[model samples]
Structure formats: C-alpha cells, structure tokens
Target: MPDGDVNAHRRIPRPAWDVINQLALRRCTDETHSVRFRRGSEITRWTLAELDQRAVNLARRLHATGVRVADRVGVLSTNRIEWVLLDLAVLKLGGVTVAVEPGRFEPERVIEKYGLRRLFAEGETSRDAVQDIDSVLSLTEPPGTDVPELPAFPGYDEADICQIKQTSGSTGTPRGIETTAVSVNSSISEVQELFRHGDGDNILVLLPLWFLQQRWWFYSALVFGHDVALSGYEDAVEMAQAVSPTVVMGVPRLYDDLRARIRASGAPVDLPERRETIQALLGGRIRYLWTGSAPATRATLEFFNDAEVPLYEGYGLNETCIVAKNHPGAFRLGSVGQVLPNKTIRFDRDGVLVIASHHPVNTRYTWCNPGDNQKVWLPTGEIKTYDLGHVDDDGFLWIHGRVDDVISPSAGPNVLLPPIETLLRGLPGVHECAVYGRAVRFLTAIVSPNPDLDPAVLSDRIVALNETLRPEQRVHAVIVAAEQFSVRNGLLNTQFKLKRRQIEERFARELELVYDKHNGDAAPPVPPVLVFG
Candidate 1:
C-alpha cells in the first residue's frame, strides 16, 4: 500500500475531536501512515486505521465493563503502543484519561483522589501498584471481537475535560491539572504551524508517555501523519540507531549526560569533525533536538550548538501547556525563545514572569495542596509565575531563577541561584549543585560531584568560578553531598528540579558547618569538600 498524500491535499485542518475519524480515513486511504514502536527484540507497526480500530474495540470493551462518559480512567504504564491505544480508546468513549506514574506515586491514592473507577496497568511494577484496585485492567490485552461496535465518535465536546495530569512537583507531591480537548488541539495546531512537521519526520520520544508533552508528540504524529518511535531512557540511544529519527525530544538531564559521554569519548579537535561525530552518535539523520522540563547547562547547550545541531528549548507548565519555544526558523542562544502566537508574557515589578493566554489550558487546579490555587491564579486571568526572568527587546525570554530561590546574603547584595547552579553544573567534577545564602555573610553550596572527579580539581574550578562572579554572588565554601540527588532520594522532583527546601533540610548540619566556618576566624573547622570526577 502506498502512503496517502492527504496532508498536501487537505483544505481544512481537522480538530483533535475528529482524530478518530481522521485515523479511520488515513488507515483506509493512507495505509503507510502508522505508529511504530520497539519493545525488546520485536518491533510493531500499526496503521492509522488499525490504531483507530483497536481503540474502538477497546472503547466497546470498556463500555461493557461500566466505564462511561466523564468517568476518570487511570493509565499507568511505560512508553508503548498500548498506552496510545488506551488513550485513544478512552477519548473515543468520552472518558477522561488520568495519566499516573507507576512507581513515583501510589496508585491506590491516585485512584481514590481522582475518583477513578478503573485503572489500566501495563508493566509488572504498575500492575503491582494497583493490585488491590477493584477494576484494574491490562493495557497489553489484545483487541477482542466479543463486544458490540461503538460509535466512531462519541458525544465528546471540545470544552470537556479529557485528561487530568500533574506536572513534576518540586515539592515531592503531584498536583492534578485539568486539560481539555480544545487546549490540546489548539496546542497541536500551534506546534504544527510553528515547526511544520511533515512526512519523513520522526520524533523519538524517550521520556515517559505519562508526561503530557510526550503524548503531545504522539498526537501530532497522528494528526500530521509522521512517525513516532517510543522507548524508555535505557534504550533511547539504541532505538535511535534502529529508527534513524530526525527529531529527539528529551529532558535537559539526558542532554547533559550525552554531552558528558561525548566529551568522555575523546571528541575531535576540529569543529566540523566534532559536529559530524555528534550527529553520527545519534543515528546520523538528525534534524533538531528539543529539551525542557529543567535547565540545560551552558556547556551542554554550547556543545550541541557548536557541533551545529540546533537544540530547541521551550518553556511551559502543566497548567499552561507550552508558553514559548525556540523553533527552527527563530531562536536565541540563551533565551527559551519568543512567546508563542496565542500566549503573551510580561514581567511584574518584582521581575516575576506572568503568563496569560486567550485559551488557557486550565484556570484552576483539579487537585493540589491547599492555598496553591490562590497563589498562582489571578483575577486578571493571568498566571502569576514565581519564576524570575526578563524578556529581551527582541522578545526572547531569558529565565534567571525562581523568585523564591534568591539568596539574600547579609552583606553585599542578593544573588540568583539557578544561573549560578547552572554554571557550577558545567564545571568539571561537578554533576549537580545547589547554592544557598540567607542572612549570612557568604554563600555556601552543596555539590554533587562526578564519581571520578578529583577533590583538588573541584576546588580549583570553584575558585575559578568565583573569579567570574560578583563579590556577593561568589560561593565561599562547598559541602560535598554524599550522594547524587535523584527522584528516589527525594532530593529532586520527577521533572529533575531540585527540591531546595528539602535538600537544605537534608544537609542542615553540613550547611551550618560551612556557614560557621566562613563566618569568622574563630569559627569551627570547615567540612572537607570532596569532588567526584
């Protein structure tokens, strides 16, 4: 069967609500347009028609099992074709799909909190997490013909809440955010125009499918008729080699680690050769890379750009989808890029960035901690972001740090931690770092060094970093953390943002020691600063 040349011939863009019909049309007419994924040694491909059929079948089965319109159905799984199928199936039945991370949050709690009647668990871990649930189903189940046929498109409205998701919580707790079909569809439309995704373009999704952005890429594939290869972090590089993907969407940590690995491989001295090497490292058909969710170090960004690979960084939240992004046609080196067409951003008097959209994804939290709603949602229909940043004259958005993360040292002036922490992360031997100083004479840092980094080298790097900073912003001493900060340790959130308050409390004594040592000549001895390679 030949690939249907529908995109070039279409006169009107179909809304996301019509995605099932579109898939049916494509499957029957455009046979070659399909979703592809890898699982272990086997690879599976499902045509648009096949995908739509499976979704319809699943929807019928779900309906028979008492799942109804507006019911919240939980999906806890890894990145696989089944996840997409289940998502489509739920949408077809006009049910809201609640995406839940398998290990990060307790499944029972989420089920009770969201009033989910049933859960679709894929992997063993996810299944185990919901063992006690009354109506847990397997996402890996094959489509059955026993159920009656369902309507191709149910009574789904664009304004109805179709999904509930939580952005990575820096506070170690998930806050559910409501999403509508209109918002998701609008986002896809904006992205399609901004990036111009077409045939032969494949976006390799390495992040968990539970994330909204990852699923957005999948929906885009269905709408624009491109390929999307889903894989876990462990097999991202291997899967890339197999698929030769043109676009790879990932978090900043993945890029940072890749940069480190490239440098470790003894990169070429020549710039062109280095660029070629980097491209070849990722299967040789590279178009561009997308990074967000956390800050990518200057060194990591520079490394890819210096190699001539454009790494596009975007800014958004679960509450606001994508606010701004750096695309192929327009970009600024240090900025997240110009605000998207529908969204507008402005800075407050205190330098906090606030966002307002004509069609906001959400206006209130579906589930969150107490008082969280009043803090962010304003009467003007603008979201008051606590992030401190400024827009350049040309409208490029540059983020400095969170407003609350400012370190007010007693003596000279206040300092922003993110920019400094970004610099420290780029320093050799430092894997991760957090800078802090509150009503103190000098700033102190908690450093997580690479295992192979030498202590002497780290000391030298810190000294060199201080030379480039203002007197007040310089870190006077560092307390080397015993372990790397990660989601498992409660030091970092799911999105890789540092839990500043938790990290500070976790190492209170060491911080106190470093502060006391730098206070005066008669203070206690300074803790040894150990650096890892």
Candidate 2:
C-alpha cells in the first residue's frame, strides 16, 4: 500500500481487512451503536453486538451447507436486515457475494451466469421463480436453529475478490464489477475522513441494498460507531420524517420528484418560511443531502440553495467508487465538488475522464464483454471513464456527457444530448425522455409525459425549447410514450438512468417515421408531434 493509503487508514478505528473484527471492536466500546431497518410501520433495531452475533451464527449455518472460501453466494432481496446479515456472513466465511436487485433482473439468469453455489432469495414470488433449482435458499428465513460454532474467524486475503456489484446498465447490459476487502475498506475510510461522521449522525439509506454505495454506508456505520436506518425508496420520505436522520443519500430523479411535490404544495414565498417547510418535509433533521447517479438540473440545485438546504451533488462510477463529492465544508454549484483525496484524475485527448487510485476498487470487470473490459480497464491499473469532463481551475469536476452518447447529424454539427435532455426533464409533465439519432438527417426524442400533461401543451413546450437550440441540435419532433420508462419496463436500470439503446430500440418505427416525414426539410422546423405508447 502507498504511504498515503497507510496514513488514510489511520482515521479508521480498526483495519478494514478484518471488518467483522472491527465491528466487534465497535460493539465492545460503543454499546449504544445501532442499525435500524424500516418494514411498513414497524422499525427494527440491531446493536453492533447483535449484528455481529447474527452474522457469525448465519456464517455457521452457511458453512454447514458446504459454502467455502471464494464461493459465489447470491442474495436477491430488497433493502432489509436479512440482506445485510447474509452479506456479512458470506464475507466472514471468505466467500464472494453477488447481490442481485430483486425483480430487476431474472434471478435464474443471474444464478446461471455467476455459477452461484447458493442463491438466497426473498419473497414467495422470488422463491417460486427458482423453486426447481436445488441451490436456491430462503433469504427471508431466520438463521437455522442449530449450527456449528465458528472455532475462529475464517482466514482470507484482503486482496481477494469478495463482492461483485452490478453496473447501472444505462448504455447496455449490467456487468459485474469485482471489489476486494481492501478496496471496500479504503472507500469507507476515504468517506469517513471527508465527513468525520460520529455521534449524533444518523444516516438513512433509501436506495436498495443491492447498490454497492448503500452497502458501503452500512459498513461505515458499523466501523464508525454511528446510527443507520435502512428503507426502500417508496418510504424514503416517510422514513426520513420518522427517523429524523441527519444524512440521506439519493439520486437526482428522487430529488426531482420531491421537488415536484414540494412545489405542488405551494411553498411559502417568504424565504425563511420556505426553508422551514422544505426541511420539515425531509424530517427537519437533515444536515446535508447527497445526490448523484444522474445529472441534476440547475433549477433543482438553485431551489435547494435558495432555501438553505444543503443538497450536495457528487460524481463516481461502479468501477471507481466516489471520485468526487460536494460536502458542507466544501461545495460548488455545477461541479461534483473537488476530486477526493487518494485518487488522481485526468482527461484523455478526447476529453474522456480517466481515474487512478492507490487503492482502487477494482482494476477490471469480472463479468463483461472482453471488448468492453479492454476499453475501460487499462493494463496500467487505471479505469478509463468514457464520460467527457474537465476540472476547473479550482479543481471541481464538471461532467458533459458520454462520448458515445453525443449526437452527430450527417448535415449539421455534432452536439451533446445531456444538456438538452436536462432542460426537457425540467419541464412540467415530462416524466423522462431520450434523444436519439446517429448519422441521421434530423434529431428527435421519445418522451414519457405525465398522464395529465396535455399533448398540445407538451408540443408547445418542445417548440419553445427548440427555439433556444441550434438547427442541428433542435429536436424537430418527438413521440410521447404512453408508458413511462421504469425498471419493470426494462427501459431504465435500477439506478433510474435511461437505457438509451433500449429506448431507441423500443421506438425505432416512430423514429423512422419521424425522419421520413422531415428528411426533405432544409432546416430545423417545429412539426406536429405524435403521441404513442
């Protein structure tokens, strides 16, 4: 390890290599430490000691089932205490964990692809889906009644691949990203150093446990002697109010939806009153809000800022965990804060972002196409992020868009799509949308408008937006999709980012008709838009 990394580890109370031991240490010293989980109207709390005991007992049960070092054990469930217990048990036994988001992807395919020795799935529906598979186990069941005791903690190397996290699959299929104990611990330490989380800090995790970041926060709570409340996205608002947590991490879409609801409530015009209203809506205890996973609108950012709400945006990838972040101590609008310590970033000649760290999460993809792996994970231990971005003089990072997602029309100049898409998503009645066209005569979009948004009103909004863009960048027409883009529909990934390829494929005929009608036009012109499912 680099000297910098060695020094960084000093902030952590115990070495992360033996994370279970570290949790036990916290349990010994901090009897008040606890992790809470919300299920319906009831909340479950587990002390550090309880958490450690359950995990060890569960590990014993797993060992009886023949689970061993390096076995790929899978967990399919929503955000729950069982998910955390199973993950800890797997790691304690020196096994790899493949946490699949329940119902997002077919459980059978994940099990087959990863060659899982055992799959612990939750819910009767999920269990029935793979009842014929002998390897499948019940995730919701309590730890077995009788199990052999662990004579001693399992032995393993910190560098061994311990976890496989799935990418958001926005551009293509979700690939498994390998992570090691050292990397996971390094990330947790870096975050703790940045925030200095301690007593009185209660974190509410709203994202699914399948997300690696969420799990990292859970581990941080165990190591740092703080409190954590886990809940699914549906109850995020209610849980926040119920728990009065000091920290909440969410994506831009969730914030946008909250912004809509807050606006619908007609916040007070008085500045102080508005601030109080917004804070109360979020449980009145949020010290700061963390958002990422997608670009946030300036309007949304400004709304929070004007109300004195600390909504800090950050940037990172599944490959390079948490490259940059904005915090209360340091923040900048339109930038994902400064690049975090212990990581170095540079832009390629094409302006694509590249990052390197002494303690990287992983150097390569464990489950992805060979070509895809070659393009992103370099032989030099650097992760090549295909995102176009640059650091300002102050060192804050600003993202443009993906190089592959850039739009290039045959007749007009090339243009980026995110800036335009961000503007459209900010408009009322627009749920989600995607701009599509490559080497084509004109640009077009497929929008999923809210049910109440009038067709004429949406057309007029698009026409108004086009007037602000260059001819090549203007969206001449759009197909208003009747169904919204969601995880169930396969138009979006679990992280709520649009699956561009899937969206374009779903609306191929509409796009062809759009070009056929407007191909002859010499310049950008607003035309009658069609609404379809």
**Per-residue lDDT of model 2, residues 407-469, tens digit only:** 777876888999888888877788888987677776777898765667777778878888887
Clashing pairs in 2: none
The list of candidate 2 runs beyond 4 A from truth reads 1-21, 24-30, 103-112, 123-146, 154-156, 168-171, 527-532
TM-score of 1: 0.89
Query: For residues 1-533, what per-residue lDDT tens digits would candidate 1 score against the true structure?
Result: 11222123334434334442343233333466666787558877777666666666667777887888788888877777777877877777778889988775666777788888777675334353243221332422465666666654545565778888876444556788888767777677777777877788988988877887788776677677787788888688888888888999988877887888778889787889988887887889889999888777778888898888889888988778888889987888878888876676777767778887656778888788888888888767678788888788888898887878887777777777788888888878777888888888777778876776677777787787778888777776777777788877888766667888888898888777666655764431233243221
Stretches of candidate 1 exceeding 4 Å from the true structure: 1-30, 122-145, 152-155, 168-170, 522-533
Model 2 weakest lDDT span, ten residues long: 1-10
434, model 2: CA deviation in Å? Answer: 1.1
